[model samples]
Target chain A: MYTSIAGSVARPSEVRLQSPRPSIPPSTAQPEPVGSAFADLTVCRHSVTMSDPRAAIVPAPAAARATDVAIELLAEMGQDFAGSRSIGETLRRALHRIVDHLDAAGGALFLLEDDGRTLLCTASVGATNIEGIRVPVDRGIVGRSVRSGRGELVGDVRTDPEFFQAVDERTGFVTRSILSAPMSVRDERLGAIELVNKRGEDPHFTPEDLRILEAMAASAALAIVNARLAAALVEQERVRRELELAAEIQRSLLPTPPRAGFPVVGINVPADVVSGDFYDFFELADGRILFNLGDVAGKGMNAALLMAKTASLFRCLGKTVHRPGALLARIDAEIAETATRGMFVTMVAGILNPATGEICFANAGHEPPLLHRDNGTFQAFPADHPPLGIAEGSADTPLPEATVHLDGGTFYVVSDGVTEGLTVGGAPLGVEGLQDILREAGRLPPAERLTAVTSVLTAGPRPLHDDATVLAVVGGSAVTRPRSGSAAGRREPASEELVRVSVPSCADRLRLLRQVVALSATQSGCCQEAADELVLAVDEACQNIIRHAYHGDPTGQIELSVHHQGRDLIVLLRDYAPPVDVSRIKPRDLGDLRPGGLGTHLIRALTNRAEFLPTPPGGGTLLKLVKRIR
Target chain B: MNTGMTHRVERRQTGMVVVALEGDVDLQSSPEARRVLLDAVAHGGAVVVDLSKVGYIDSSGIASLVEALQKARQGGSRLVLAAVSDAAMRVLQLARLDRVFVIHPSLEAAITGDR
Candidate 1:
């Protein structure tokens, strides 16, 4: 009364039964009688079915044994996985248990990849280096089980048409049978668990084994999904912290607003946590103030880095390069060397003379800054050349320089983000809208005007889609608070006989000399052209002293005297340096096409009888330049 | 501090390189101007420096032109000044360099080697 079943007992009714003491078919077909100890045991070949009367009596106990084993295995797997540290370790332990409990040669656990069309073997047991192998999701028997969301039992995989032999070839392991079940949780199929070969006397996997694997797969899928979510959250947090640190560093590089008495105000607001817009204004060594506003090409960390480098370069080069065009050319060369592909900057830089409310600016492919005149009108200064970093070296066309006399007026510069900002109706604010805002704020002070512009931007229905930056320079009547020791605020009395000023012999210091000479020339009724010539002559005289007498030493002293005697304007420039040889003081031949030796020539050409005389007591050179009014 | 200046190069059909200069070429920009002029001279052809747009030229800028002349002589070419501004013409007259280089009133005249 013993029976053995093999090759997946899919239906219990398929096994025929025979009575022990009854006439069955023939004497040759009689079943062998078993002892009491083996009475309930049933054995059947993988391809054959036994015909014994008591064979049906043995299947009940065999089915019950399979159920007990499946329940025990699932309980043990849950406890083992709860103690595992990582998803990979849990899967490795589960694969080992599945192979050992099912009496199989080897097993592999594959997880679905993010792309959803492939399965990656994350853990393998009893296979040679099969971990990390990839298989298409719809290619093999394992794929079928995962796709169908069911367990598959192939008794003799060599005959099963869906059996893929690639894994066997890759791992060099022979596969006789396969039992695969889909790993899924709540109707979501993650991957599949595959057992390669049956190892016990049965030699083929049973249907009962397939049922147990499917149950264990459900628990494993849940554990893996939880671990993956945790890892992703940790990575997200790390990236968020790095961005915040980058934003803080960028914020420190921004310039702060000047305290009271200064007429410049600048502000920047970032669309993201970091900004690519920057503005800076600082007084040069001379009394003239230098200011610049720039916008980098893009947003975020790369743009912020370039913005910092550009601002720092302007500060460093602005001290020596008084010309805005030259400074911008140098900056363009530097940025072109190291900037990322498709990266460039648009900038507007200027120098302002607070004494006369005169401002000169150079534009480099930036939005034309608006000049708010004292009469409450706005004029736009357009871009003169291509943006920096587009080409190497100086621009082919002159960088446009505009001189505006701001008397109780303002000069406003804004990034495109201000004009392109959106309104409640999804329409762009445009340049006209900006003009309206600037006109309204024209009556307010410099700081309050900036506030009004910012309030309009933030109070809009839609937030800014890009970084916004604004810089305003208030001039003329607004600049009544004169700096200490500045002669611009002092008016000489008609009875005063003389006005004298002394300055260091430097290129930048020449501006002060020009200012004082301009005042004297104007007082003497010299026309505008004559006044300009007087300033140019004095500047050339001092430059000659610095270049020739002092040999470019900026620390030397040059005493300048300006006096209006009747209808003639007189200017005396006396330098305390080694006296130049008067006989050799001649302008170079212009036909020679040389760069030097023009300073002395310019001095003589622009003045009325320029004379170089010997100083009696000081032993230096005395240059007297006179301009007579018509 | 008014060091406003700009420059550009144009190649003519007659194989002359015309470097047009504008604004004030002074001590601040003369070195760069010198490098540009010398580079043009090294190319070994008739080089014309157009100063039509130039409002002023200082001693250092004039020196750059002189250096370019020497380089052009060594390179077997000629250097000319064209479209010299009135403010710059006064400096040339005072320096007497007007007699040195072939001066032309326009870039076209300089390219055709016209006086």
Candidate 2:
């Protein structure tokens, strides 16, 4: 009876599974006792016999047998799947179990591709190197089952119009019957599971077989979803760490606030983890301060990197180019050669002379900075050329510069984020709004004024969409006049008769020493030439202590005292550094042609008498410089 | 007044390039001064850097001038410093580089290769 059943379903040249021995091979078979729960799960062979007349009619016992086999197969698959290390491995094991349990000739598991228009065969059983085969998502019976989220059972390829024969033609296999089910987790269809050519006498698949295959597919789908989610989470974590590092590097690149008496303050706030805005204020060796504000074209890591590079270039070039227009031209040429296409920088650079209240500024496609005059009015100096990195070569027209006298006034530079910030009503705070804010806070000092503007701009609950940067330069108080005026032309004595200060031996403090010396010399009735020479002598003495006696150690303290004697103006400098070798302190030969070791020479040349003596009750150096008051 | 340092390069009728540098050549202004001086050296002719207006110079400024001197030698040309300011000359004397280069009292003297 079984022989006739097997012969009736066999095709001309199709590989058949030899069955009726045990359902699963002994190597993979599990022990089952008689009358156990899985006893009804004996492999069913379709045949015409006294007890069963129709081969396709699944009776109550046959239905029970299919359910029992599906349950046992699933239990075993769960264990093996849990032990699998990779997604491919899990899918491979699942496909093997499905083909073995259903007694099908072969099976393949197809997964959705990233494009979502095609399915790639990720794992396959009974096929040699057929992995990575791709088929259109809507092309075959497998595609139909995936689309409908249902199982398809086709008894014969010739009778089923939806059956796609291309796979068979490609793989050189003949298809007799097929059972395919969509693998879906919740509402998302991941892919499809397809089994082909049921083996033994049961070439035709029953509805019961389709039901069992569907249950297996559901389990496989759940595993696939879990793996993909794990992968996505890892990728997210990696990106987060990279952004954190980028933010740290950006923060380190920001410049520190300028010292007191510099009349400059700057602030920056990023809209995201990193900002593309930067500002800097540093004093040049010529007593002029160089200040700048810049904004890169975009946000995030790329923008942050470009901002750092642009700022560094400005700092290095700013030291060389005193004219703001010439500096911008050089920066533009450098950016054009090094910056990526489509990326550029908008910047405003200027040099401020505090004593004379003179400022020379150049703008490059940036927002016009507002110059608040002492007369309660503001003027905007707009860009004269495009932003840097956008054009090749130097600007056609000389980068126009605006010279403004900033006595008792302020200069403000802001990024676009200030004007484009949204309010509660979703309206942008235009440039006029920014001007109003500045005007209201104009009464406050430069640093406090910057704080007031920031609070108002970022007050709304809605976060800013970009980086906001503000730089302000306020003019110094009207105290020191230009050194060009001769002291003999003055009508009044200096404001102070005596001045003394104790400060750390640092290069930055030399300016303070010069101020005190100039005051004392003027009060003593010394002419401008004599007073200037007195100040230079004292400055050179302090520099020697800072550089030579202290070896550039800022922790060392220097005491400066300036006073007028009966016929001599005297300046005394004392430091607690190691005692100097007075014998070896002679100035270098003037005929020698090199740099350095000039502090002693300048001090001696400018002062009537410069004497180096030891401090009382201590091991330190005390320098006394004097000039006759005529 | 424009107190900031400035430079200009001129080609003399005698085929010598004269780079006139004005202002203080300290740490802040050495880079620009370097560029101007080096360009004169690269032009491959007798170069004279006129420092008549330079009132001050630091070690960094001297280093730039030395670089110009080296470049002039590599290009097989003469480099001379003219009208050296007292302040700048003192620094050059201290560093002992004053003996290395040809020094002249004025631009005309440098152009004529006078001592």
Candidate 3:
């Protein structure tokens, strides 16, 4: 028991009772050193429980006879020995009570520290400032009482060698009788409360003295024990409050639900009191949407920290990054340079068309997301590259792009926890189990369907080992698809210096303009105007290239480059061909006011700007026509 | 060319001087073009930047030539760009540098009697 003077914050008289009787009390006229003996005497304002009023209800001792009357003499002092109620005055009052009860010259209370190895005399009276005398556990008569777990009674301590003479040497007090008992409650020992010299002016302590002081030791132990329990309860409550506050802040950082216009849905769940899985969804400047999900390597507090850091880094990169493959490459390079070793994250991010339904996605060694077809079939689209934080640069791992139509079909995505869940009988709920569940649950509402499937998968003996999270998107539709056709239509400028453009928006404008712009300077009229026409034609043609030929997804370039060879506005249009057939157009059909399939008609109406050219590298369908305006 | 800092700027006539800069005329040290040409043109002279000594150049290095031309014009003087560095020439060619700045054959040929 560490009995700390965690003592009441008060002056020496109010806080501790070190000198019961002053053999050399400090002079009222003189000053004392800052700390000669009182350095270890602590004074703290502690909130201790006051003594209960009901404690006064005690049975009176049996009637004292003649020899017993002598025994009753010590009991008479018992009235003064009653313990003091806790306050700054407790130590002072308790010391006076013990001096009267034991019929002694004086008494002292020494408190131990948190560790039982050291003691500091906490309270004293009579002898002046013994304010703080340090004593070790195995040193003197007080120590002997603690070690032997009993009282010590001795007569004439000046002859006794176990008696520490340093106190007598310092205080000049006579040492004749000593009665000490270990102050303890149950198994805990605080320190010793000892009475010195007989008050009736006797020289030695009797056996009756030992019994009297032991009673006082019992009362002292109870007071110290109660204060300790109060301190511990307050500390435990403080720690619990701090943990609850920390957990609340962590919960607020999770991803918000998607907005009305986005085509994806994402979800994340942490297994413990906190989790590290995170997801974010937002839009890019070009009307394309960006969404990502990342699973951190570990769980609990460490995992949550990494999850937050990863989200912040992703947002900074995602803003400047546009293409899905290019974005992933930059992200991988950044994480590889900064991520801590042996700890990495797996992630998948993608861009989607809220209007056209085109999607580009990149995965870094994450679980292959499952795509469910409208007809109840599913395909596992696995990642072609290693996980993030493994390597840097686009060349490190060739992450491939897989495109699929998502019109009227739902895509089911999840962490590995779903596929790896097992039944009570030790069989895994593999892909087959998932497909079977999806087929049955497909008819139900999407949110409810998820709840029903997760329950069955996570039921019984071998359920999920970690937190399970699943995100499902029920959609499949695209607008404005690409088509190819062949045509033999050409337009020639009627004048001497004018160059004409035929079907300028037909994926071959750059090729046509480069040829015409080069030849325009040598022509008879308006060189800059001709060059300007060719530039505009090139712009329109590139737009057509993206909309046509490549089926609205051109991953390569169209060649419209050409050089001048004098007066001829010789324009050349080159591409790998699916040539548009101009003969199929009915001139009378334009009267019907139909909007689409007018590719050549629009090109013809926009420009006699340059000659149509045919310069396909394969030697097929290259349109080369020249016009001169003068 | 009696070169100074790996280059030379010799006044061949009253109205013109041929400043030939050598080595990589990059952003760090293209200021020699402005210092030498501006000083020569202040005396009511014209100039020609002989690029025969230059090994390379970029856009910031190009600004010195434009400043020289602007100062020569303010003095009612003329300036001509002479044979450019092959590496520097290629960057100029890509941005159609031939359209904006005049090209000459040699320092002596362009500045010889232009005053």
TM-scores of the candidates are: 0.54, 0.55, 0.41
* Highest lDDT scorer: 2
For candidate 1, the TM-score is 0.54
TM-score of chain B of 3: 0.80
Better of 2 and 3 by DockQ: 2
- In angstroms, what RMSD does candidate 2 have relative to the true structure? 25.5
Stretches > 4 Å off in candidate 1: A1-85, A185-189, A395-398, A477-480, A484-630, B1-115
Model 2 compared with the native: what TM-score? 0.55
**Residue by residue across A400-454, what tens digits does model 2's lDDT show?**
7889987556889999987787755677778787776665565454676677666
Please compute DockQ, using alpha carbons, for every candidate against the native two-chain complex: 0.28, 0.07, 0.01
TM-scores of chain A across the candidates, in order, are 0.63, 0.64, 0.46
Best by TM-score: 2
Kindly list the per-residue Cα lDDT of model 3 for residues A108-146, writing each as its tens digit. 777776788877787776655565887777777877888
Q: Local error of candidate 3 at A501, Å?
A: 52
TM-score of chain B in each prediction: 0.91, 0.91, 0.80
lDDT of 1 by residue, A1-630 (tens): 232333334333222232232322354233233111111122111112223323333456776555445444454455555545677887888788888888888899988898889999999888565889999998889999989988899998889887888978876778888899898777777999999879878888877677667766766776676667777888888877887887787677666667665767888888888788888888877778889999999988888888889988988888887777777888888887778889899999988887767888888889899987643458999987777777776533336677887755678899988888775567776889887776544434466667666667777777778888899987753343345454543322122245788888776666566778878778778887778777777877777888888988889888998866444566778988877776566544344455566666566556644555546486788876656554
Pick out the ten consecutive residues of candidate 2 chain A with the lowest summed lDDT.
Answer: A11-20
Best by DockQ: 1
Q: Name the weakest run of 10 consecutive residues (lDDT summed) in model 3 chain A.
A: A41-50
